[model samples]
Target: MEVVQVLCMKGGNGDTSYAQNSLLQKKVISLTKPITDEAISNLFCNNFPARLCIADLGCSSGPNTLFAVLEFVTTVDKVHKKMGHELPEIQVFLNDLPGNDFNTIFKSLPTFQKDLQKTMGAGAESCFVTGVPGSFYGRLFLGKSLHFVHSSYSLQWLSQVPRGLESNKGNIYMASSSPPSVLKAYYEQFQTDFSMFLRCRSEELLEGGSMVLTFLGRISEDPSSKECCYIWELLAVALNDMVAEGLVEEEKMDSFNIPQYTPSPAEVKCEVEKEGSFTINRLEASEVNWNAYHEEVFSRYQKIVADRMSREKTEFVNVTVSMTKRG
Candidate 1:
């Protein structure tokens, strides 16, 4: 709940907005396209639904918000054509936390709907899209209401920071200096959150319905892996640097925890088995460069900014990220 109150992305198409920084997220959706295609294949193996209900959980406000959704729409249209079945009426739910810039998403829908109509041809009339705002950690829809669900680069966010991390000092998340207790707290929290997530989806999805989730994950159990918590470690370093200049209170740094976790594949599999709801059809992972765009551009930009801020007494850089769905 605190995460919801404090969690908001860089709204609008500004320099630091999620709308601009989300190119990496768009890339993740593309990288996981095969998984989504396989899930859609299973969804339509039998008679396709005349009216199909799909939900894109953690659909943040950005130009790329509809990128994955349109892919699904096209795939569904193609499969029905191949099977000689009528195209289904598609009702899409774009979900995110309350703090999301839904205005941006809604504003763009007018153009999106028009483009979709042109692309979908006669099938356009059957397609409907609406926004569903709230957390996905709990039940969000009626029982058996959803046929297919997709989440991209979300779900790593815990419902809240793990309990008992207040004792953790000087770091915002699990880092090299973090103790065993902090790691244990994070692990337990993830188990609880992931199991709850599965349970809720189980109630909402029809029998044999499919879901595809692509989020940040660890390659191993080590919590300090560069893949696991390097981002947080860097954040801690930056915050502590500010504290040294008497800019930020030490207590503030100690109290704040990044309300997210990068679960290992084994951890996710274990939770699914414990939940005993959905059958795991496909599980795969691959490493990709963190910067999907030109890395040199960022390096040059950082250098220019560092030169200008040499004697700054305070630094207030508000980086609104497109990671609320579960990042």
Candidate 2:
């Protein structure tokens, strides 16, 4: 699939919109708050930039988008105030695919600004927020412009679905049923895309800049582990059932696959090492349980997910990594 052209969270503030269904992502932002705080704090302390430029990559629209930016700003404000330094003029960029709900984010700016003013008092006046629409796998900012970068619940999405996966039929992702070739293609795609991401960010980040990233991951070395792929697997099962009922085309289902990969910590470390632009400051994994299940309101697909999750008590593995650009 053409991810940039097609990939976007459901827009606007409706019941089915991403803005409403993104509680999980909000939890993820909170989950990695400490890491993000430290990254911003360290960057500010090392070299106080009078004008601080920060980017939240894959910053899908909603409260969660600005939540991250607010956290970074809050951290810098606290650190600088503690050190008795003047507050910096904060230039904030929210980045995502061209199809992202930038309009929703823009419309909500008044409230975000008010909240900022309420939280930071006079210091909030110096903050400027803007949206940059593009894929982060390529350059999105000027060279050496950003000091601290943050991405949460993103980057597990690949630039595109892996090539040569015709044999990966019946499964939408790297599942246990997938053949060796399918798994290999997925891993290779992740390595390529992640390395490119690091390279682009390195060019945009100032010397000694920091990045804190959180995304779906696995604790196992196995590429087809259930922790990473079960969600997709269950999704595939629903799709297959639809195919069986003639509600969807089998050919279309067979041709489709999710353009995402959940890398193990070792895989992430290896790619970062191979890219050779940044040093890993910290890498940690945590498990988060699936949210409470409600059977009364669920559709067939939701029921499938809820039922399996209830039975297995499956938890998603989140990997958060902190990195610093070398001088």
On TM-score, the candidate that comes out on top is 2
Cα lDDT, model 2, residue 184: 96
**Candidate 1 Cα misplacement greater than 4 A, ranges:** 292-327
lDDT of 1 by residue, 103-165 (tens): 998888878777777788878778888889888899899898888898876788888889999
Worst 10 residues of 2 by lDDT: 291-300
lDDT, candidate 2, equals 0.88
Instruction: Supply candidate 2's per-residue lDDT for 137.
Output: 93
TM, every model: 0.88, 0.97
User: What's the lDDT for residue 106 in model 1?
Assistant: 83
lDDT string for model 2 (1-327, tens) is 487899899899988788988888888889888888888888855567799999999999988888878888888889999999999999999999999989999998899889899889999999999999999999999999998898888899999989999999898889999999999999999989999999999999999998998889999999899998888888788888888898889899999999999988888899888989899999999888765323222356687887886677688899899999987
In order, candidate lDDTs are 0.76, 0.88
Error of 2 at 306 (Å): 2.1
In lDDT terms, which candidate is top?
A: 2
Candidate 2 off by > 4 Å: 292-298
- lDDT for model 1 comes to 0.76
